[model samples]
Target: MRLQTGANNQDKEEIKKIAEWILTVGEGTAEGNNDGATEIEIPNDVLIKSEKNHVKSIVSAIFPSIVEHLNDKGYFEDKAILVPTNEEVDSINEYVLSKIKADEHTHFSSDSVCQSEFIDEFEQALYAPEILNGFKVSGIPNHKLVLKEGVPVMLLRNIDQSNGLCNGTRLRITRLGKHVIEAEVISGNNIGYKTYIPRMKLIPSDKRIPFRFHRRQFPLVVYFAMTINKSQGQSLSTVGLYLQRPVFTHGQLYVAISRVKSKKGLKVLICDKDGKPKNTTTNVVYKEVLQKMKEDTTF
Candidate 1:
């Protein structure tokens, strides 16, 4: 499969070298091997990075065009807005739900059984909202739930991968029940097909917290917006990347930009700390990882 990007000269050269090395290694024939290895070639324009302010410009210049394309394809009927963190996901979900006039918000109920008797009051207090907020800042499977028919959502677990109901799979709610939700796959091979999602017990682990707690809830979240990390393995038809904060980790910016199948389907909004538009964007790439790959040519 060919992966394209809009990267600058430096990044393009580095990516090209990496892609060439991968092709060479994969197609190299082993000693005493009778069968010839399958040859794979990397496309010349496989990796491209958007120029500085390119994404912002595209979003501004073609906002209406992109919206028209989405509307024509019925993408807006079901879509995923990719963000950078869980907190942002929750915040955006709340905002979208509020705007749509959906008021039903379900909070997860935790199991009260204590696992460790050694847990003191201080350690137990870590699970409280005031304390847990500090730790739950970046975890998975959100504790709060909001359901609205026709809203897009993402599965948090692998209920059935072969059937396209897996982690990061996007779906639109067809029916919402107290114990189960019926949804139609909107972005996978099973698009237009429906599936049933049931409430399940979820345990979140954070090193900052001393004790663990289990919360029982549906394994899904409003995918109107989701963290970029959670969107790694999924292909989105229409992607709105809201960068309220600059991405801090390596490959985050790349991953976020590359989620959409094409540039026409992408819309990026980069905001400053004060939520205003910003001209420049920050990209974090660890060059050492590339150096290591170059040094280890034996593979």
Candidate 2:
């Protein structure tokens, strides 16, 4: 379900261009060249680059002097740097975190392997506490969480839906305490509302995993930047698509570009496999899947 139009977003011709290419590619008509490859054209004006150092350039363009604007909810509300992979997301977050010189506080979690009748002691022994601590499961926080005051972190679980502390909620750290972390909601209806986040026991929700385990940790992740997969269904005013490497999955390139509501708020950075400057990137679309769906839907 793609967004045809976004409320409060004026004039989405830029979005239309991106969406059209995605549709063309998805519908199996974009490969007009003899080489059997499709390269979506990104507008020159929106092709963001200032000489070298592309990551810093995009980060600066999205977040300028973030240290000083920690108090401003609007600063992090509409702005985000989106990456294609988790490694890039972590790199950008670290780079942004280094820019802030505030003292850091670390929060470590307790990890344990859940006892399942299907699993044996040998399997359980393999997943030691140290090994469990290092596990990076989707929708779960890390074993060690380092945070500072006024930085944005996203909620990974639905602690309170009525109060708007749901999954993917963004909040800025207002105060750090021994037992709890104080933060103000930066996204959704509860924006500017302050709340306390408590440590909770969470299990791996990712289906790709073979075993079940629990980790007692804060359900949060630093939101300076996020991966494209995680950014799905998130609406933002300004978004920087930091595609150091091109997207590898079907509709990912489309999802990344379509996140921004308005034409003026979207900026994309694309490069080749060698990491050189480039204006175009491959767009993956499974026309066979679309055809299969069409056949299934036929009356």
Error of 1 at 72 (Å): 11
Question: Stretches of candidate 1 above 4 Å error?
Answer: 1-78, 102-107, 111-139, 294-297
lDDT of 1 by residue, 54-109 (tens): 33332333233432342132454434666777777777666656645444646464
TM-score of each: 0.68, 0.87
For model 2 the TM-score comes to 0.87
* Model 2 poorest 10 in a row by lDDT: 28-37
Q: Candidate 2's residue-wise lDDT over 160-271, tens digit each?
A: 8999999999999999987898999989998988899999999988888777889998888998899889998798878898777888877777677777766667888877
Model 2 alpha-carbon miss at residue 171, Å:
1.2
